[model samples]
Target chain A: MMHPSAGGVLKPACYAKPLLRPFGLAWIVMMSVAATTQAAPEALAQVDPPTADHSQFEPLQQDFASGREVTRACLECHTEAGKQVRASIHWRWEYRHPQTGQLLGKQHVVNSFCNNVTTNLGRCTACHAGYGWDGPDFDFSDDSRVDCLVCHDTTGTYEKAPKRGGRVLQEPVKVHGHPLQPPDLGKVARNVGPTSSETCGSCHFFGGGGNGSKHGDLDTSLLDPPPALDVHMSDAGAGLECSDCHVERAHQIAGSRYQVTARDRKGTGAPGQRRYAATCASCHGIEPHPLGSDPAALYQGAKLNAHVDRIACQTCHIPAMARGGVATKTWWDWSKAGRLDADGNPVKRHDADGNLTYWTRWGEIEWGEDLEPDYRWFDGTMRYTLPDQTIDPSAPVPINRFAGHHGDPAARIWPFKMMRGKQPYDPVKDRLVYMQLFGKTEQAYWQGLEWQPAIASAMEAAGLPFSGEVSFTETRMAWPITHMVAPAEDALACGECHARDGRMAELTGFYLPGRDSDPALDRWAQLALAAALLAIGLHIGLRILFHRRRRHTE
Target chain B: MTRTVVMFTGLERLWHWSQALLIILLLMTGFEVHGSYSLLGFGTAATLHVLAALALIVVWIFAIFWHLATGEWRQYRPTTRGLAAVVRFYLYGMFRGESHPFNPRPKRKHNPLQAASYLLFGVVISPLLWITGLLYLGIDLWSAPADLPLAPIALIHVAAAYGAALFLLVHGYMITTGRTPTAHLKTMITGREEIEEASQREQQPERG
Candidate 1:
């Protein structure tokens, strides 16, 4: 039974009313139900998750055969989603670096991996957030081409395979004489929701051809991490997602490596105010250690606190990388490729650690586990080598040169995974050439054997003159290792950096007491003290001699 | 009087010289480990220092047990009974050729100043060095305490080493105060010293 006073507005003022009022019980019940029905949507919107069940929607009930069709279906209600996706880095593959004002993007930057995105649209566009990007003329303005399922798919089966021209197969297809089933796109599109580790890892974890290759710290092991492996991401621990630190507003993710916030001094900024959101100092402030009054949390070392100025948080937090039972590629030599068996099939070799040291695919690879990162001064800005940039063949050309050097106030020594490559370049022009590493149709390199036709066709596609002269040149790139956070106990001990042969002994232009020597200064100080002592002894001997002479005279 | 007194037993001299050699070895490598100009490389210095510290500890154990078993520990008993006389002799009386107030015997080997300094070294400085050195050695091992104020602890250890070095200097200077400059130095090697036998009954062991 409902009271008339309580039923009128469902206000807190009428909650303690025990007696019925002048209105009828039937009318009160009817009015209360109507109020509840009206208030339901606002209550639903203000919870932990804002997403509703998409399968219940009438448009999503129909089967989706293509990624474009799924995008079309998604756009029926979310009319502005395609426009938002178009402006994102994931969609445009472009970012004008704020510090350098350089046109640095995945499409323009030539990396030391498979090199660049040019002349290999069909193979590279598999990870692109659009469909049918098979050629240079692929329309960027096509709203229906935006891929909603790649990031939104709740079903694990949704996939866009390489060499398929960014097309998702509707049915099972045979590849390399092995039958493979197509992902259930219809079920994935219908059940779209928040992104999981699997959705993000689909492209990120598998970067540079293998799991844990490009970023040694991030890999498939992060999918379901143990508490010790990643304290922040572990389900049994703090259980935070990537979106917690790399916060997103609208559709644009807040953090990026290219525009890194190397030193975040202003502390945490508002969602739109930050340059790069994923910084340790932003959340915990500059002095993070010995966080509170608790005994276990406090690593109360004076030296450790002083070291924060010169070294990045990742340098100490992540002592050894590729710790999740995976090896990262430390070397890639393309000059060793084209070694074929007697049957004309490409041959490969593996090292004692079972790392694919000699892979016929793309280059001769070398892997390392638990690698100590190479450190260098970086102030976030970097120079990307454009295809038009001329190279000096004498030295190993840095693909993306990390800017800043020792003694730069804005710079700090950051750990990076240095990859050395002997990749293809045009000898006559002295410029790096982007090769078509994989493609299925036409003059694609994977289908069409040898480098001559592939280089000619690829150069023609990219609108660059290849003098028909190709040679491998030595190149290197340093990718910063930022993830695979260990527990506080596993961090580097104080003595590891303060001991005689410490890790930071070779750090340039620095003077450390335990790791540095000043024999001249030490000797001088000791000699000064010894001389002072000798002077005191001589004064006493003189006093005694004077007193004895006085006594003899008396 | 040409009387001979056994100031140091053969075992006592053996322990004293062996401990001194080990301490010198420890300090050499210890300073090298501190990057105070390395003689032996860091790896060799660290290993040798640890080995020498362990040997010193073994020698200390035997010396302490022998002193307790043979009742020779009373030789270091500090007394203010003749302290004023000892100080005056060193300050003024020694220059005027005055008679000595205290003499070395089988049971009393140290003057008041020597006994006090030896006590400070054994009870305070040596223990501080041992505790800090052992704690530092356990680094990279499971026994190392987490959340320790390591820099301050290291500073304390270095300060203790400096204290030991200063003690060595003062000890070297004490040799010149003997009847002859080489009298005490020869006693440490030969375990005997020349003394007048005025009171033979006074050589009985007494509890400190």
Candidate 2:
């Protein structure tokens, strides 16, 4: 309870003097007894306050000497490096006791994963080292595992490990781990611009937990370069590095909430709140579009409008020339059923069924033919016949069945032989009448085969009796099937389907290929002006009424 | 007959109207910029915001010169006497229709509260906005230096913006503290205001 500033609240003279010593000792003992009694009237036993389970705490291993040793070792080559390390957060990774919020320093007794009373040797030292004492488990004397190069590079190359192995032979591994290596000192230390889709995807692509923890599927294969994803990086062809957007990597690694300062290229500090765009605009330019124009408009009106309409610009245009490519969501069947074919190629097709087919090739799909059926009605029912006799009924067929009838089966039946009442009836007329009326034949006497009633029975069951064979005219669908107009809910104008900017508005929302139109942004301008005026008028009217009433009263 | 005519010069009135209009525009645009309301129709709103800001800067330049030449800057000089009184009057007394301690005149138009508010608007809020805006405008020209940190600058910009927003809220509330609460606002519009009776005016002469 004595303050640090007070020299000596407890005097040695009082305790050492023979005459007063006894009285002082007795007084001290009496006071102690009284204080103890007052402190806890019910105290029959003493209990230690619960500390962090520090059975893991131990003497510093030989590997981790004092920070002084590490500093000295680092100073042997680079003296200022220790200062930088001191400013880093890794030096202070200890946690406070959860219950009391007390700094549980190295002396705290705790258990290790091994449940031993010895100092925490393995688990704690992995990240935190150089401390003389640790939890009961670690030995402070062990210096073999203390890696100085985890952050510091003494070799002047940023490589974590030496790349000595060649294509033909592997080099002998060194006993001592390789030293730290800094990047090329001569090269300008440019920040990696904002983290791009490629950078994010390098860690988050298809095989990387598709949409597992990330907000969206970062698989470059599945999605176009989304606008939210580094659009500027893709469009401008600026070589942006990860460190540019993820600024202050040495100070604040990703995922930590620690804040850090950023400077524009010229060192003028960023304006307003430190937001995502504040760091992003350092290289990508302040205004996203030219002259603060609408980005969507510029993209739609560009010479590459077809390309832009088909795919987002960012998908292909990356921050750097090397990074540019059509980004797609790598279709990882999270099911993880073997993705590759027998030859270790990505299985392009599940089977010939086309139902569950996925093509590995990028870009547009080439559509071949539109062998869709065009049925014509000759009687009550519709039908179309294929010319190929080898076509199997069970095999899946791409049939675009239009709603119309084929010729009546009563019109044609081949090789009629049956006679009705022996009047030498015309075989063609009788055969045609029988085939058309009944949609069946007793004559399959041709081709040396007997007549079958299966087809007729099947048609009757399906409520569509085959009337007659109607010929179909074939046509081929074009490559790069750009437009597939199916019946949608509402009749969309050309504008609705296309972008509603300058060019589209000028074209009056019509989808005429290769024609450019200017959009009507003035419509929005008029609306804004009217709204602003209305607000001002309301504000002014209120002011006037209030003032007029006040004057009359005065 | 001592007419209060020509008290606020034409340029002063122009500055006042334009400044108010620009502030409103800036606020609206700023809110939209922050993704608050889609009022100005995003793109055009942004365009108008820059235009109005340029207009405001021009108006501010002229107003600064006018104030310097006419020595009308004294209107915003803050004083301690009746400072607490003016604050208290606005805080509680005005609600009960209490007579103000600082009355408006040609010589001393603004009360202590008004002067303090104007000082904050002119010195702190306006400058902070202007500096930040200029920084934003010239971001390309003045690149962020490698050694210099951006966090502090961003913090200052955001902090100043919030401070201006707070000032605006207080200014709006004080606007309602006039005789019928709109007396001061009327004068800003019509460039004319009716004076209090001579007896009332004499009772509450300008405080130091």
Total backbone collisions for each predicted model: 0, 87
CA lDDT, candidate 1, residue A532: 51
Fnat of the models, one by one? 0.13, 0.00
Q: Report, for every candidate in turn, its global Cα lDDT versus the true structure.
A: 0.70, 0.35
For model 2, how does the per-residue alpha-carbon lDDT over A1-554 read when each residue is reduced to its tens digit? 11121122221111211111111123234323332333222211122122332222222112322234433443444444444444443344332434334332222211111111122222233234233223333333343223233333222222212221101012234423433433331120111112334433433342211221111222343223322233322221111223334444333333211111111222112432233322322322222222213443432222222222222122222211111122222122211222446785644443242322343311111111211111121111111112111222222221111121112222111110010010001122121111111112342111112212322332233244344332111111111111111111111222221233312233222222212221232234335546655654565565566557667788
Q: Is the docking of candidate 1 incorrect, acceptable, medium or high quality?
A: incorrect
DockQ of each: 0.07, 0.02
* Tens-digit lDDT string for candidate 1 (A1-554): 11222222232222111111111232233324433443222221233444577878888787666788879889999999999999999888888988788887787777777777877777778888888887778889998988888888778878676666567865676753557678777688778876767888878887887788788888888888875676556654334556555666667876687877776665434333443466766543454443223322222332244456667888887888888788888888877766778998877787887767775656588888888888778887777777678999789988888766555657887888888888888899998887776666456555654666777777777787788888888988888877877766677764555466777766756544467545554566477558757855984586568667868898
